[model samples]
Target: MFVTESFNRQLDDLLERICSKLQISSAQHRLAQDRYETIGNWLGARESPLAMFNPVIYPQGSLRIGTTVRPCSGQEYDLDLVCEVQLDWRQVERPVAVLDAVEQRLKKYDTYKTMLERKKRCIRVNYANEFHLDILPACPDPSSGTTCVVVPDRDVRGWKPSNPKGYAAWFESRAKTFEVYLAEHQEPLPSQEPVEMKAPLKRVVQLIKRWRDLKYADDQKIAPISIVLTTLAAEHYGGQQSTSEALAGILAGIVASIPPRNQRLLVLNPKNTKEDLSEKWDENPDAYEAFVSGIIAFHQSWQDIARGRGIPSVSATLRDLFGEDLTKSVVKEQAESIQKARSEQRLHMQKSTGILSGLTTAGSVSVRSNTFYGSQEVLP
Candidate 1:
């Protein structure tokens, strides 16, 4: 009942295609980068309060990790940026003051003033349908080494520690291992440049995130956040060379990494120990249950495919897992490719045999029946 190597290849191809579709296009990537750079320049201007602190703005989340996905229907992709203000936390007692300062500077620009929205720890600037930039104001934390910084928490009315850059570095290191494996074992992706390698870990994360989006399209509030999925998947990755194997491995092991909680599960931030990625799990049990169910469903679906059981067709199962549109597209493309190969094989056999429709003609039937082991007439 085990699936054949050919089937596995087909499945991997389909999954890779789906991942490609989910990726943010290069043009969009450049646009986001340009927008952020302009904002950084404005914040680092001589007259700005942030300029005195040597503020540096950079990406920190999925965009930095190369795991960014296109936003779902009617939603904007978030570009998480850290506005690192180089100042001692002790000197600036009020952390919220830093947030206020940044907001005020942004208010100077009428356009930005209208687009800005204050969040728990960051200022969000909306770019209409393109994307939203979440700028987290952070200052150096003396206790947590150089990489750590204290970000403001309006809800707690205090400063909290975080290390977005450190976390991104750790994630990038993991991503590199997969990239090297891909370089050695596979051809470069058509969409990627020769020098630019696609990491299997990134692809795996993208796939899981896309699945989460589809599953929770209606109730996004309860769905597991990107950091949770990214962290868990990266933590559980076994350096598998293939995306399908990596995904199956992650799905199987991700649940084990979730700490058991009578009330709430705690997914600790690897860089900053104080932060919990799954903090919302405590308030919404249904969301946590949904996440658990999703992992189980994903793992079981892959297992069923591997074992050739339960599912009526791979396409149907994949459609249920991903979405109807993406699944159908991949399946159709694969079917057409298979048909072309079969047709080519038939044409090749016909040419090799020199047979065209009928073999009753003299030239077509060159080998005579009298040609035997010791016969005078040799077999043509």
Candidate 2:
């Protein structure tokens, strides 16, 4: 059943508050950008071999897509960056040499020396209490023009192809199409200014990621990765303007898109067919099942909130989905707002009818047989 207007308003308010809390502060953003720029400048110094290739450093994943969320407790935000150099793959016999060169140069700097560590696919630089930057050194793929690149992977000990720019572009195009559809249908577009203006899609992604974090807090290794969840949600989103509505649609749509347990789900990179986002699902069925269960639980909680149950029940459901601290804060704010409205309505009725005899002490008085004074007044 469709939710009441009052319930929808409350849900929207709670979601807006949650999204605001999930986002990193402006200072955090500036710090991360400055750090990346410093790394880029260092890598592109005239004395460095990478300078000859005219290396270009840019963000690739969540940072580029604008879906970044604040890291959970004891965890640091991850920043994925690509250091693309204009070099001929044919001339470089060993792709790992490229990664090694980048790592070597980064080690030359005293600031980066102790923070840097070699990962399977990237050079990780940890900035304690802030974020970790994963720098993937890559060379352009001649076959794919400028969109695709090949990076060295220590796990496979070979060069792997990726098109992060292309994938991001694809996602942007899908968002635009959904927004246009909403506009044509006379529904509220995600944003009138630009896709980045409202960031409904990004907010929904962040909320889902946070839910995944909470669900698998104990067994993080088995938790669904951000990329997989992001791709699925983006694939299924239909331009929901509000964060909560968009989240519900994404959760239901993604769960329905998943194949049965007997079959392995294939979440291919939209830009590169060779890269499978869900490759881990085949290797670990339990993790995949857990992800599905989490989605179901999220949907159930969403439904409970939509049912227009009393504030206490809805607050409990929200706490079950999002944690006590966030739920309590948001519910308390909503309760206060509701109480304020009732007070204003009671005062207005007292002045209008010049009768305070029937007014109840509960802030809400029955004006007639079934209607309460403040209950019917929908706040703007």
Which candidate ranks first by TM-score, i.e. highest? 1
Cα displacement (Å) at residue 136, model 2: 1.1
Candidate 2, residues 117-187: lDDT per residue as tens digits? 89988999999888999999998886864588888877777788788888899878756754665566665
lDDT for residue 162 in candidate 1, whole number 0-100: 83
Q: Write the per-residue lDDT of candidate 1 for residues 210-260, one digit (tens) a residue.
A: 888888899899889999899888888888877888888888897665556
Candidate 1 minimal-lDDT segment of 10 residues: 371-380
Q: Candidate 2, after superposition: displacement of residue 131 in Å?
A: 1.4
Candidate 2, which ten residues in sequence have the lowest lDDT sum?
371-380
TM-score (C-alpha, index-matched) for candidate 2: 0.82
Q: Per-prediction TM-score, please? A: 0.83, 0.82
Q: Considering only N, C-alpha and C atoms within 3 Å, which residue pairs clash in candidate 2?
A: none
For each candidate, the alpha-carbon lDDT, in order, equals 0.76, 0.76
Q: What is candidate 2's CA lDDT for residue 355?
A: 33
